[model samples]
Target chain A: MIGRQSILEADVDTTGINSLRNGPDDNGRFGIFGGRFVAETLMPLILDLEAHYRAAQKDPAFKAELNDLSVHYAGRPSPLYFAERLTKHLGGAQVWFKREELNHTGSHKINNCLGQILLAKRMGKTRVIAETGAGQHGVATATVCAKFELPCTIFMGATDVERQMPNVLRMKMLGAEVRPVTAGAGTLKDAMNEALRDWVTNVDSTYYLIGTAAGPHPYPEMVRDFQSVIGSEIKSQFAEAQGKLPDAVVACVGGGSNAIGTFHAFLDDADVKLYGAEAGGHGVDVENGHAASMTGGRPGVLHGNRTYLLQDKDGQILEGHSISAGLDYPGVGPEHAFLHDSKRVTYAPITDDEALEAFQLCTRLEGIIPALESAHGLAQLMKVAPTMGKDQSIVLCLSGRGDKDVESVGKYLGLL
Target chain B: MTTRIDTRFAALKAEGRPALVTYVMAGDPDLATGQAILEALPQAGADIIELGMPFSDPMADGVAIQLAGQRSLAAGQTLRGVLGMVEDFRRKDETTPIVLMGYYNPVYSFGVEAFVKAAKAAGADGLIIVDLPPEEDEELCLPAMAAGLNFIRLTTPTTDDKRLPAVLKNSSGFVYYVSMTGVTGAVIKSRGAVGEAVDRIKSHTNLPVAVGFGIKTAEDAAEIGKHADGIVVGSVLVDAVARSLKDGKATDQTVGAVRDLVAEIFSGVKRARG
Candidate 1:
């Protein structure tokens, strides 16, 4: 469905040796980063989901349906725009944008939601539940669930509910019951905890539409497969436009879905560099002050997988801080952990102030308002683009449109 | 190879009575009050104690235990502090088996090997790590079992018989059959189903089958105890502690609140097969 390759044939590292893309080996582990670290109550259900997903992966009808929905419903092949003004402003590399922002629901999240909701339908799940931080994923999920006519519930942090109000309203309009969770700093981690609790309680009829490339096994793998369309599109589109691969690719990391999606196709390309920008709230050096899990934290288990977590020495999960509610989670996906450890992908911390500056810069220069999450990638690009040769190019995944963030940006900039 | 958990369950089986297992968060409300509750549990008729090592995120728990962990963490509980409590409890009582129960991150953070050794040295009889299913036996269960600690596994209503063998393969101490397919503190949907589940699990392993998750009231315990080798009650006891708190600090009645509830539940356990 993505890039003229079947899910099994295209990415299969037959030797099982050195394909960075072929991760999460049979145990759902990405080199000790991901595993099914869940309770027994959820094990049978997780295993069942995995079985269904595997079956769905092989079934051509499932792929055909997903591809149809992707092209017709969500609008695939978002334009690969050459950001000429932004490149001129940077005064070095040619900056190209994979305009995931142009997709329906204004984000790359719809790509995954479409794929997962179809899987839920195939599995005969009666109800759908998801966790959201900035409400993009929630809205995307609600959109797909609405089209599919599945009853939907979304758990969002109370703090996020207040800050991301417009997106919350959007989810409501799309027919999702948004439950505000007030637990643990009222952020993404708490919302995920509540969602997992809900899944455990409603195991029989409910399908947990996890919003990130994290969680237990098959999720990181499944989400990457769904989102791989981003990178695959970038590959063919860039080849068509530029006649070669970009020197580098960039994406912001929250739970690292968009980043993983953008990076998966480029993993085997040794010439292409990958960068993931994580939220450095104030600073990573400041204890409990950032959401840059790989930059400031260690490997620990939470929310059903082992990954880099912002945690204290006692292993208690620290409530991570980030100006962008979408990037406020304490952990990144396990594949990112493996990538960080293997030194295949370079992950860096983008501070709140830096992201805000990039947000304004992109809005003015490219006339493209970026999501706060995607702005982190732009912040990283602002630093990297100036160092590269003018002929070299960097493709950044503009993961979402920034309309949902204008109010928060206005409040932050004293415009309100 | 017989752990304190095995000995205690064997003793309860010999007496033809279901073990009354009580769970109290290691540092709920405050340190001293939580310690007092731990010291008071055995005297109040709790045959086995599931000491909760409070973690920041307990995904499998309901609101009651979630709040208890929050209160404990707010009161400055850590994995080290939990082990210290176990050491302190061991100083007073030697027979009551203490199973450290909670999510895995805190223990994983403490370093699994070191935590297992420290837990064994500190007098923890077993572990009920809510997160580690049998697929991950090598992570902690095998190590803890290698160090002579009971690695108790939870068997849910969803764990069909086909998968029961794998779930029970590496499991030690006893088989914890969650009476329902939900988090802690929800009311059980059917009492008869629990009896049938217990019988189904008993068909597979000789390990004592303890049923938990929603055994709140004395009548609930009595009904469940009729089928299970042990009846585990937690959220209500933690809630009793929560109720007895004044201004979020432990009141004089905090320890006694949990003690009295365990006593009431024990009375039901006593009448289970009578």
Candidate 2:
């Protein structure tokens, strides 16, 4: 009973700060996580970026331009559909899917990409660079670069390029020069290292459009601000559709942009429980086998910020494994670290098998195929929904469409 | 309170010649060969040494240093192992200043206070953490300086006059002026621009300014040394170690190869003012 009371008290604002969304205080720190941990070469530029972003936030013209593009270009107000069959089959809580996959470029990645590319244009940056894992962010960034008439380069691990060839082809078709990095395990970490190398070399002309909600200070904050549209829309649509807030909201967390975005709005509503699903490749208990940073990692600095990372005793970052390349990184976003520590959000590891099962179940039951990244969230929902009462409701962010993952999923399932 | 870095730089200032600073990854290829490489530097004409504390991810470095770090990690070099190498090098020589250079994660993971105490006891004179800027001085820089270790900061071409003070505020030992806006092992776009940047940095700080990044050979060292207080070289020497390795293991020529390059580059530093 004492433990249950403590869990109830966790909702109280212990920091005396009013809102959970008011994080990454001036130093880019969210309760000792997230800071500008980049090299001195990129420091001044980062400060300059923060200044521009602050001004852009204040300017009405900037908001109008972003809003205009959101509706007319990238398809804002992505549909919120109640999953009738999935809910009935689970026989407990009602399930609702936030349709981010139906958006342009087939994922929530475009939300951040569109905002960043607009900022790049405003900064007069002639070239763009980004690192990607599953190629969703890469394809989204390449899509924006083509629309903006800027030359862009996408650095991807050789392994990711091999596994995600469909996205590789899509990026190439969108006119991005995809540079395959062969360093380390040839994964997202190596790709990020290569992209940083390129950004440092071409600082004067290039803009690094970070794909995730991690990285240095302004990037985490800026990316979250761009992605907040997800939660904002969910708030209104859910209110109108059900006449009340859902009991819980869940999303898949990689570097955690989509989760942070979806979690940002409901954070102040203490009654609304927020959940995030992490990639548990084999299992969190197995060494070097999972991407569940919050579940299995400790606080360490990597990729320009302090976050939970899968590293060894010697502080060497371990290359994490996941069926979904998007969630294969060793670290999670700093905000998620803060949220996890603050107990405002519950993050659980969903194994690859569970996610695969949920993937097939959602496809068969709802007639909607979700990205493997999103399948992790559905797996979490499968666990939580059955435990809740029939009157309760849950919203799961279907972060991307599974089109790009078809071949990989097919191979894994022996259908190839 | 004077560190070996300060003493060595002051001594070279009196000698009217820029110091030759050589860099090598600690425990690169293997521990024994890396120790031999460190021991040979002073005699090979290196006035100061920057021992690379290899990390899993060296983001600011180019391909050569990156591969060298991989080779070092593969050979099982831990942060503790790097400190042991420093202790071993101090057994024979004490005048050549050693600055441990790398990113901040390994040191942060080693426990900042304990690592500082261990590093000072290990006879390391200074630090050159590439990721830690002035904003993060509270993390390691101030603590290190308080414990009598010089915390060197790197100033790139992009660090403008307005931002130079904050960078130089907690800076001691020296200001490492990156000659260009790029990672290690790159070709310098203009030699003349490096001289100007060095002069600009000299105008702000009394600390000896050493220029690094993109400096590959003796001739390049000579030209850059004419304007700066010291010349720093790393990737090319690491590349020499790489080229000498046969099937990823160090050969007999491994130590000799780096010594030969250091001797040649020192020759250039010697003739810069002449």
Candidate 3:
């Protein structure tokens, strides 16, 4: 068992003063995994963002303000509930849910959005830009932008806009102008390309509120730091409930914000295992299946950071497909790539069928409708929990609510 | 021996006129048509040629070039296929400088050493890798230079004085000044801004500064040529090829149309000072 410590305060300390998750050394390299591989035009802007983030890291007021927002505004310290039915149904490990879905935006994406928006405000930026896949991050960014009264623009894949209609409406309702990117395969990568282009064009006045723990430096690190509250709270909540750290932590990885948030605190804890579930649309058959970057992809550069990417033999990025739009990105967080290489985290692929079944199982057994993205972890839970010792426990980072996925899931299951 | 890029720039400098560097995606409609356009570029008055190596994901390009790349890829264009076009172009006329321009992934996939050797053997003169920044010079820039290929660097408006040295440190052949902050095909906002940025780059380095990314017409070329060492028109030419296409196949207008635009641009550039 790991030492009993105040989970939330211990690691969320941005000072990196005493944290086990030390990474992205000086040049944004996570053991040759993460590096700034962007166009030269964005370099100066990125450097400016890094300098501001570094300064904010040292500022006590910045941390205090962010902490306050996390608690009072964003409704942090999200509950870690013991899923009694899930544990009994699995007949293996005791399954616990880190209720990030219960957060303000009904997802974990709000954590990073809040942090980055605050940074944008702090940087004197009046406008904000973001990219979204399933539009969770777009909704979160639009929410924060509305609150701050900042002009916001969101770049979403045209295909995603057609599928994630509710989110598109929500962003518009929140006063954000959503731009549909029709480039490439008309997915998350294309949205990111448009967002980057917008940033390069309006770098002086606009702040790119990247939704995931990906992108160029400061972004991967900044988003991870903001979202680390999930892991920090998990550390404390799991200890409060089970009297010690859980045996393992599982979360779905798209750009891996939620997974990183839940896994950041447990990186140094050798006893606890970190299992990240990548979207396995059909079964990771690279030709037509999923977005399992580590499983099917090679190390390559995309969107700024060099990480595990779904690309062709000639380095051209391939569009990844998944039933879950949020989990369909071809590139994963750079830190996840680093952890995969270091063997600190074991990544597994969970297919669409498996996730669909898990979604139904949890909805009926526990009366909880999980996001398709989060269902990936629950799918993994069903696979590994039964084989594990009954004495062990697993904490699934329930990253998002399922309301956004009902329509898509219905279509997938032939219920629509 | 000075590379073709350097030779062309020196020749232009001697003639007291700015150079006209024309860019076209290889195998846009088809390889045969692309080769025909390539062979016709120099005679139509292109001082140097920047042949685009098409990749599926070209992050730096705008709509025109992206479509061109997509069309080339759809037509089954590969790294070998683009290089083959260059080699085919080299069979007869060899005076016009040839520079292969595109993202790094294709060359990286082709194996850098092997790609460089192949590029040099194919009679290619230079490279304009958009994604490989100064920080990543060791990846391809230094190696290409070592192989005697002019690794051209792009200096944008955002490339400030502080970052100019690092951007120019390992740069060779000539400097490409992206007149605007956005991607390729964006309209040049101001000829004065292009002039000022070009002067800024020239002040830092002695290398010729070739301006691109929005010179649309001969008048635009003439205006920019006054301030730049070379005038580059990519998107318009790519759009020209796109417009001249008949049912996705290059029509007779493809080569003639490109030559017509280049002829106008070449004349406009010569009128800068000469």
- Give each prediction's DockQ, rounded to 2 decimals: 0.92, 0.88, 0.62
Indicate the residue-level lDDT of B90 in model 1. Answer: 95
Give the winner by lDDT: 2 or 3.
Answer: 2
* Better candidate number, 1 or 2, judged by DockQ: 1
Task: Tell me how large the interface RMSD of candidate 2 is.
Answer: 0.6
Model 1's CAPRI class is high
Q: Best to worst by DockQ, what's the order?
A: 1, 2, 3
Lowest summed lDDT across 10 adjacent residues in model 3 chain A is found at A1-10
- lDDT tens digits, residue span A1-416, model 1: 22212252354433235677667778999898999999998998889999888888878888889888888888887999999999999999999999999999999999999989988998899999999999999999999999989999999999999999999999999989999999989999999999999999998899999989999887888888889899989999999998999999999999999999899888889999999999999999888889999999999999889999999889999998998999999999999999999999999999999999999999999899999999999999999999999999999999999999999999999999
TM-score of each: 0.98, 0.97, 0.96
Best by TM-score: 1
Candidate 3: Cα lDDT at A235: 88
State the weakest 10-residue window (summed lDDT) of model 2 chain B. B178-187
Q: Please, what are the lDDT tens digits per residue for candidate 3 over residues B1-274?
A: 5987888788888888889889999987787888888888999988889999997767778889989998888888889988888888888867788999998777877889999999999999999988888877777898898898999988888899999999999988899998888888987778888888888898899999989988888788888888888988899999999999989889889999998988988878878885
> In model 3, which runs have C-alpha deviations exceeding 4 angstroms?
A1-20
TM-score, candidate 2, chain B alone: 0.99
Q: Candidate 2 DockQ category?
A: high
- Per-residue CA lDDT of model 2 for A187-224, tens digit only, reads 89889999999999999899999999999988998898
